[model samples]
Target: MTEGVDPRELSDEDLFRELQHLHETRTDTLLHGSDDALERHTSRTQELEEEYLRRYPERDVDPDRLRSGARRRG
Candidate 1:
């Protein structure tokens, strides 16, 4: 449905919203959708994610989510 919109043209708020929507539907699309549908979802997800990263290159990192953090916790 959102395939018609380009990630580059979206605002920061809209891009994040689209990313959330895509992620929410990802499981169903992967398990049940057709190959064509899955491909489109994957492509759109990547485009939006890349744009988000481009805009927020300095996003805060959560060290507890990293590999080293896991080892420490264990």
Candidate 2:
């Protein structure tokens, strides 16, 4: 897990990489870690996600479309 650096301070590419790393850590915790570990990962993932969305609102995903399996026309 990355430490010390603030997500909001990261460059776009770095932030996305951090987000990807968090997702992977969360998945790993869910599969093999203690409940506490999973919870921490979940919380951190949410925090990073919120920051990412705040920084790049255009990249935000629509919850409704996500649930309905709809794709953006681009």
The candidate that wins on lDDT is: 1
CA lDDT of every candidate? 0.91, 0.75
Worst 10 residues of 1 by lDDT: 1-10
Candidate 1 lDDT (Cα, whole model)? 0.91
Model 1: residues >4 Å from true position, as ranges? none
Return the clash pairs for model 1, or none.
none
Tell me the tens digit of each residue's lDDT in model 2 across 1-74: 55447767878898788789877676678899998778777777777788887977897576656735554433
How many clashes does each candidate structure show, in the order listed? 0, 0
- Residues 1-74 of candidate 1 have per-residue lDDT tens digits of 55668878998889889999999999999999999999999998999999999999999999999999999999
* TM-score to native of every candidate shown: 0.92, 0.64
What CA RMSD would you report for each candidate? 1.5, 4.8
Task: Evaluate residue 68 in candidate 2 and report its C-alpha lDDT on the 0 to 100 scale.
Answer: 54
